[model samples]
Target: MDLELFLQQLANAISLGSLYALLAIGYTMVYGILRLINFAHGDIFMFGTYMAFYMMTSFLLPWGAAFFIAIILTIAFGVLVEKAAYKPLRNSPRMSIMISAIGASFLIENLAIVVFGGRPKSLPVPDLFNRIIHIGNVSVVSITFITPIITMVALAVLMFIVNKTKTGMAMRAVSKDYEAARLMGIDVNFIITFTFAIGSALAAIGGIMWGLKYPSLLPLMGVMPGLKCFIAAVIGGIGDIRGAVIGGFILGLIEIMLIAVFPELTGYRDAFAFVLLIVILLVKPTGIMGKNIAEKV
Candidate 1:
């Protein structure tokens, strides 16, 4: 590919990768803290987008206000899912929790179909995001450039919260040993809830970005992205925050580059993630940046 074409493809890859990174972080965060995959997370993403859509179109709110409200609502919904689906199974077997997660995911999807209708809704794109920008020989939409910046800023803020704050310390403690953290007076439940809130917020932002980039909404929209991001998280080492970002970028780049170099394989783009997952499992089960952890008896 020529330099201009390569740059264009690269921009698209980065934008796609940033969205994956944002969503992958949520998976990693919850897995890190609770060792549970929030299967309903993708639905939570869909929920946020729909909420924003309605707020803008039905409520007649500005895009900024709609997005803010959507994020808040998504966070609350996420927390509610935790309390209803996962919290009760906290002390139960891991299999039980996983099943509950799956059930919750299905419940949300069906509910969305019932309430939002089966027809796909078009997300109202803001002019700011729709504007085209030119740089030398490469031209792209504003969101193509904006996505990576937002991802980076979100990552930085998350890192600071996870590494520098008291809550961060508590989260680490709880992750290590929930009972021990509770014994030490840390509110384990609260920490878990907070983690979900943050994860949900990231999902909300990612959903909004995805809506802007794709501009189409469906009840099942989050399923593929959710599964892909889960793959990204696992590939990057599920519990490592930085690793999740790396995994997302790697997945995005590979997907875009594969299709660009060989358009015939475009049909198999989704399969690539699974193939990569299998390779990673065989080569380095702990992931590129993951450390081996012994399971407790």
Candidate 2:
């Protein structure tokens, strides 16, 4: 209602949107290549968070080093999951692959519960990241303000890697037609593995940032962001990189605005997305930027 409140809400939306965008990129990239929804992605995100926790607490590593290590381990976990679970069923019925993904998700979540315990842990935050910067009517912490910029830069780098490099070409080819790509002498397995690696790495960045922003670390923390990011990918037209970013921002704005206007609906935040999802599916199942893909049956 007031300018100050509006500005604060806007800041919150942008910060929240950045995290969504990072998470959505991974979803969109994997979906683009494999045409499979990795249900375990959320758990992979949780893995990243735990990796960060171990690096910081056990290894006594600096934040930057811990973050990098988390990325590496999380990426490895994702690749291993693919090799063990999804890859075996790559040639099987689509439903089989989907089920494998679901199984993997369950395995990771249960394992996390066993390892991290049922109790929630608070993420260790450095003092530097705790400072708030007040500019004009908008009051956002330095970490909050800077996070979106970092996320956007990361997205830009990802776009360059996916669109401008040789590997990028191979990825595009696989996404377009895997069999055709293989026939063209493209290393299908390598490209698929690379895709998973990058996707998982990006998810790690998001997980770390999410932990930094919210300061809560748990096995289930990824569930909400993972689900929300999936919605973002769908809204932006699944498989489209730019679409995912746009969708993330839009979804973030909607959620923040709804919560700001009607605090009571805070309980309905998840419901809000499904409602919007259903409406979008009814109106444009292909999403805002999704193309009508016709397959020769």
Candidate 3:
């Protein structure tokens, strides 16, 4: 194995992994607090790209402005989805909630297909994201490098909020014991909506970046990333934010390296992630950073 080739592959993995981590943050956050998987989370991401497309082409908005619109709409949609599909089920069983999430995911995907059409659409490439910089012997695109930096910085800011701010405290409170927080006069709805908003925004950012990198937009595009990110979240210890990031990078690295080294196994790239996930489950069922909750009997 060429060590230099392996390192280059590793770099590629980090770029892809960062994107997965960004998306997994949303997934793990919702699950951490509510144990509710927002299946529509992926579609909210899909809508984000559409919002950007419309703003840029129809409204003649600048790329930055269009991206901003996409983020706003995605957040709003996420909040609304929680209100419509989840709030009422706050008292429901975990299985029912998971089903609702699946239903919501399907709803958004079908609606997107109807509105956006079944054909794939090209995403607009702004001049600002077109730069390419060389690192050593490796050539990296501006979007690829900038994307991970932006994701990490945003995560740092989020960590500060979760660990230091009032809202973050409220979030922790909700996650720990929703009823107690509600009794303490925490606005459950607002907190939940806020959580969804942030999660959706992350999904949107990931979606936009994925579009820019792949340069293709389709309603079903979020499926693969969504699944991979979910696995990453689980592998990183499902509810741990930092774990999600670590898991994402690990997953990305593994996938990229596996394909690079064993070019013949490219078809099994996705299978490798699942196999790894299963192995992790067998060894550390809680995941790399997953916490242990001691139930009070």
Candidate 4:
């Protein structure tokens, strides 16, 4: 490939990888605390984009305000989902909880269809995001440059929260041993809710960015990205934040580069995630950054 073409593709990969990292962080965080994959997480992403879309198009809100409101709504919805669906099944069988999660996902998707209509809508991109820059022989959009910076800042803040604060300590305690944390006076429920809120917020940010890059809105849009982010999380060591970011970058790069090298495989791009996932599971189920913990006999 030509140097300019390669540079453009690299920019695309970085932008896509940053988004995957955002979504993967949410999955990893929830799995860390609840040990359950929030199947509805992707739907939450869809919800965020729609919220921003309506806020801008219908309510005539500024993009910045709409984005902020969408994040807040996503966080609220996530907490509500936990309280209404997952909370009730918390002490029940794991199967029951998993089933509930699936149900919630379907419910959200259908509701989105009913509410947002089945048709795909064009997302309104801000002029700022569309601004283009030329670097050497390559052209790049503003969002492409902004995404990695945002991802790095978010990652740094998240790491500080996870490693430095009291809440982070509580999260660690709960993840390690929920009953033990409760016995020690930790509010396990609150921590779980907080974790969900954080995860949902990250998902919202990702969804907004996704919409900016792709500019299409559909209720089911989250399905593929959600699954891919989950794959990214698993590849990065499911519960490890740093691992999720690394895995996202790796997956994004591979997926982009694959298409670059062989244009004929454009239709098979989505399949790449699953293919990589299966290989990772077979070779190292624990993932690159994952630590294998021995189960107590």
Best candidate according to TM-score: 1
Instruction: Go through the candidates in order and give each one's C-alpha lDDT.
Output: 0.94, 0.88, 0.87, 0.94
Across residues 1-297, which tens digit of lDDT does each residue of candidate 4 receive? 998899899999999999999999999999898888899999999999999999999999999999999999999999999999899988887778899999999999999999999999988999999999988768899999988888999999999998999999999999998889999999999999999999999999999999999998999999999999999999999999999999999999999999999999999999999999999999999999999975422
lDDT tens per residue, model 3, 1-297: 676677677767888999889988999999888877777877888888888888888899989999998899888888889998999888888888899889999988888889899998888888667677777776667787778897899799889989999999999999988889999999988888889999999998988888888888999988878888999999999889999999998999899988998999998888988999899999998899998876432
Residue 99 C-alpha lDDT in model 2? 89
Question: Can you give the lDDT of residue 65 in candidate 4?
Answer: 98
Model 1 stretches with alpha carbons more than 4 Å out: none
Each prediction's total of clashing residue pairs, residues at least 3 apart in sequence or on different chains, is 0, 0, 0, 0
Q: Model 1, poorest ten-residue lDDT window?
A: 288-297
In model 2, residue pairs whose N, Cα or C atoms come closer than 3 Å (at least 3 residues apart or on different chains), thus clashing, are none
What would the per-residue lDDT of candidate 2 be over residues 1-297, giving only the tens digit for each residue?
Answer: 788998898889998888898888899999999998888888898899889988999999998898899999999999999999988898888889998988888888888889899887877987667787888866788778877997889889999998899999999999999889999999999999999999899889889888888887888888878888999999999999888888888898999999999998999888887788888899988788899876533
Q: Could you tell me which 10 consecutive residues in candidate 3 have the lowest summed lDDT?
A: 288-297
Model 1 has a clash total of 0
Model with the higher TM-score, candidate 1 or 4? 1
TM-score of 3: 0.96
In candidate 3, position 224 carries an lDDT of 77
